[model samples]
Target: MASNGMESMQLAEDQIKILEENFNRVSKHPDESTLMLIAAESGLTEEETAKWFRLRNAQWRQAEGLPAQLGSVKD
Candidate 1:
């Protein structure tokens, strides 16, 4: 579990690039184990990785003119 304030920390450029590459290869919402591996590689907590995915997915959906509820794990 992560501390509340930990969510505000920014990832380094390399970490963001790595994450972006993986995101492009994978679905917007990756499975838990894959997410954990990504978190480890990106030097982010699982919470931050999840949050980033959530936000990025929302942005992607908006750009595609899709509803936010579509193609989400929560659906």
Candidate 2:
């Protein structure tokens, strides 16, 4: 059960990377009009888009590597 949750989290992280790249490409002005639109089109809320990118940017700090960053910390 716990492992399933972990897998889902990792998939989320991978998705974050893709979105981060997309955001960077479009957000060169940092205030581009499409920021909201892109986030919405990606099926993520404005808040969730911001949150996931934060995690994606921090991927380098993850010791287990990107795919294993959210592994069962308890198990």
Candidate 3:
């Protein structure tokens, strides 16, 4: 059971790494196709990928002293 928990944590860490790499290199507010690609790469569902982006954006905005609101992706 403890091993299972550790595996889960490691999996989560791997997923986060994938997501973070895409978020930094790609668009923070990715389009549907981009989101799908990222989700597939991260081994996450589309909804989960979207939620991760949303939460990450909020965290970044807070860190930058901006309001935690959704913003349009730059072209």
Query: Which prediction has the highest lDDT against the true structure?
Result: 3
Q: Is candidate 1 or candidate 3 better by TM-score?
A: 3
Report the number of the highest-TM-score candidate. Answer: 3
State the lDDT of candidate 2 residue by residue for 15-67, as single tens digits: 55657667567552223345566566666676555555445434433533556
Residues 1-75 of candidate 3 have per-residue lDDT tens digits of 123222233348789899989989998889999999999999989977887787778778878999877556532
Residue ranges of candidate 3 with Cα displaced over 4 Å = 1-11, 71-75
Model 2, which residues run further than 4 Å from truth? 1-24, 27-34, 60-75
TM-score sort, best first: 3, 1, 2
Per-model CA lDDT versus the true structure: 0.77, 0.50, 0.78
TM-score of each: 0.76, 0.42, 0.77
Cα lDDT for residue 52, candidate 1 = 81
Which regions in candidate 1 have their CA more than 4 angstroms from the true location? 1-9, 71-75
lDDT head-to-head 1 vs 2, winner: 1
| lDDT at position 8, candidate 2 | 42
Q: How many clashes show up per model? A: 0, 0, 0
